[model samples]
Target: AQTVTQSQPEMSVQEAETVTLSCTYDTSESDYYLFWYKQPPSRQMILVIRQEAYKQQNATENRFSVNFQKAAKSFSLKISDSQLGDAAMYFCAYRSPGGTASKLTFGTGTRLQVTL
Candidate 1:
């Protein structure tokens, strides 16, 4: 069984600044994937970034990057030059590489409040 944990329930960031959201997980499997999904008030889950367990280098997408510490089982998301549009509920998720019933295990979620 795998589980994701977001220690911070809520976080706030100023526009044009940067913020790092912390996340940790527990899993027995070595092969899997970690992800960060941003869901605005609209409730649409947007894939922010993903990192494979075997990849030594972290994953990055534009202003979004991940600090993936495989040994520590910690995967955190860093948002650069935060914008008002970035305000949303961020969720950390995990998915096994292969399984008969593959499913994404998500964290409790962190509400991101963006201020000017």
Candidate 2:
């Protein structure tokens, strides 16, 4: 079974600072997809970033980026210039390609506390 892991249960960052959240996974499949989803206190899951297993280069989206080490089965999220709005529960998830409905296997979740 494929599984995502977020070691940090809680983290804090000051406004305007940068924070990196660590993630790791275990999978037997050759091809799969990884994603970082942010869930605010309201509980809506939003896609933060994604990385394909076949891609060697890391993926970045504006203030968000990923350090994906396929060999090590690690995928960490880096949030730059953090803001109060960035405070949320971040979840690391995985999905196998060509699977049913692209169901995501998510981690326990990391609660990010952004302070002013």
**For each candidate, how many residue pairs have backbone atoms clashing (under 3 Å)?**
0, 0
Give lDDT per model, in order: 0.96, 0.94
Candidate 2, residue 95: Cα displacement in angstroms equals 0.5
Model 1 agreement with the true structure over 32-54: per-residue lDDT tens digits: 99999999999999999999999
Model 2 TM-score, 2 decimals: 0.96
lDDT of 2 by residue, 49-113 (tens): 99999999999999999999998999999999999999999999999997484889999999999
Clashing pairs in 1: none
- Model 1 CA deviation exceeding 4 Å by range: none
Model 2 per-residue lDDT at 109: 95
Q: List the candidates' TM-scores in order.
A: 0.97, 0.96
Lowest-lDDT window of 10 residues in candidate 1?
A: 94-103
Q: What value does the lDDT take at residue 16 in candidate 2?
A: 94
lDDT of 1 at 4: 98
* TM-score winner: 1
68, model 1: CA deviation in Å?
0.1
RMSD of 2: 1.0
